[model samples]
Target: MPALFVTGTGTDIGKTYVSCALIRALKTRGAVVDAFKPVVSGFDPKDAAGSDPARLAAALGDPGGVFRIAPRRYLAPLSPNIAARLEGETLVLDDMVIDAMARAAEVRDGLLLVEGAGGVMSPLTDGETNLDMIATVGAPVLLVAGSYLGTISHVLTALVALRAANARVAAVVMSQSLDAPDLNQTAQALIPFLQGAPLFLAPRGESWDAGALADHLLTDLRAP
Candidate 1:
């Protein structure tokens, strides 16, 4: 049951970036890891290599992992509900993703990182949000947020939403954004709101000590 559901305040908030970093970091420690992105939109089969699942699959050491990892792939850059509908398909969240996550959890023991699509409130289907996905998995969350202006409110709001869903937060990463209201300042302001969850500030680009963060999570999560 060692898994982390990496979700963000919104799309493109570095959830995939943090997930891949943690995957590589865990791999470096000789840990068995698997990443699952149940649904992905804005995906073009022609450019599959550049998709999020493709990148995650690469991190999992599988080049063509997209085929096996994400079962629901949509063409449009919209929400999964719309994306699936546009393709003449319907995404019943439970039908499409729940059992897949359950199956992935059963087979993978080391670390299963379930990367959710879009923000917590983003539509996953006609009736579900990413929050429902997190609730369905019941995995500890590693909330990813950016340091841009208004992110303090965004992160806190996301955290509150998770709290409302009764999701256990494993950790939080304030992934640096290109624009900002100051990284450290934003992080400082967020500390008291986490209800004791640890927060890490990652560099906007590479050079983030993802391995260290990985180690911390492994150690901390396992703590008695």
Candidate 2:
């Protein structure tokens, strides 16, 4: 099974947006796509209309509902470790890995999209970060970042951290941030500093389409 781990420079940087769009695009191309958000915080079961898990489930055609998409969720909008602690719970790294791998196995012939909770270094447990999850899962990463002031630095810094951990970054997506400057220009300026990972721009707008972006990724992944 081929799995792509989606992580961001930080929270609210469009990780879920990119993941959902890509999943839709892949499905448009006749690919069986499934996604999982291993752990989610700030989720309210009673009102999940605008939640990340709900959005993800919708993207996956609401397969088995939001709970199936993200099995681990907390009400506190904080780091997973802190949120877990606040509720008198703890996250076990091995257990998480087991579940993720099992889910991937279920879609062995399709794409398994794993979305991280926050930035690569965001804590999954007291001693584990999202970086560890990526490494343990051995999936290529798609780093999502916001196009804002100082974004280039943040993207490059995140690249360095992932590289140090020997994680393979498939690409870097500069998603348009609220009230940010032109995203295309930001992507252009970021190209020179992105090492070799391809830079992509996700324009800001409600009707923005990701079909073209999805084509680029499929072409790259299917290359001989």
Candidate 3:
């Protein structure tokens, strides 16, 4: 099975949004898709309806459950390591890798989308970051960024870190942020810094559609 690891410059940067849209787009192209958010913090099992995992399940048209989508859930809205420690738990990188592999196997020949928690350097366990997870999974990346001030620096920094880890960035998506600069201008500004990766602008508000973004992504993925 093939997978795309969806990561971001930082949290709240629309990783889930872009991922959901990508799943929809892939499905529209007759691709069977499944999504995963391996480690999720700020989760309340009592109110799983509002969590990222639940939202991803909904996006996959499987709103009935979330545990299958995100196996690890922590209560605190902090980094995974701290959150796990707060609950007297520890996250093992190998266990996470095994879980991801198992889930990927379930997807079989379909596309398995893995949504990383927070930024690339966000700690997963004591010494493991999301970057480590990406490396362990050996999946190409779909880096997501926000159209906010100083976003270019964050995006570039993440790109450098990922490159250092030998991760392949398939594309970059600049998601529109509230009260932020113009998305088009933001994307244009990033063009020079993007090296050769394709740059996409995801507009804010009513005009946003995951299927449309997926079309662009599929086109790129199919390109030689």
Query: How many backbone clashes does every candidate have?
Result: 0, 0, 0
lDDT of each: 0.85, 0.86, 0.86
Candidate 2 segments exceeding 4 Å error: 222-224
Q: For residues 3-76, what per-residue lDDT tens digits would candidate 3 score against the true structure? A: 78899999999998888777767777898889988889999989999988887888789997599888888999
Regions more than 4 Å wrong, model 3: 219-224
lDDT, candidate 1, 1-224, per-residue tens? 56778899998989988888888898999888888777899999999999999989998889977978787899999999999999999888777556556756675657778888998899998988989888887878899998888898998999999999999888899899886778898899889888898898787665566987898888876666
TM-score of 1: 0.94
Error of 3 at 60 (Å): 0.7
The local distance difference test score of model 3 is: 0.86
TM-score of 2: 0.95
Residue 212 displacement in candidate 1 (angstroms): 2.5
Cα lDDT for residue 185, candidate 1: 88
Q: For model 2, what is the error of residue 99's alpha carbon versus the real structure, in angstroms, after optimal superposition?
A: 1.1
Q: What tens digits encode model 2's per-residue C-alpha lDDT throughout 170-212?
A: 8888889988878888888889888789877787664667787
In candidate 1, which residue ranges exceed 4 Å CA deviation? none
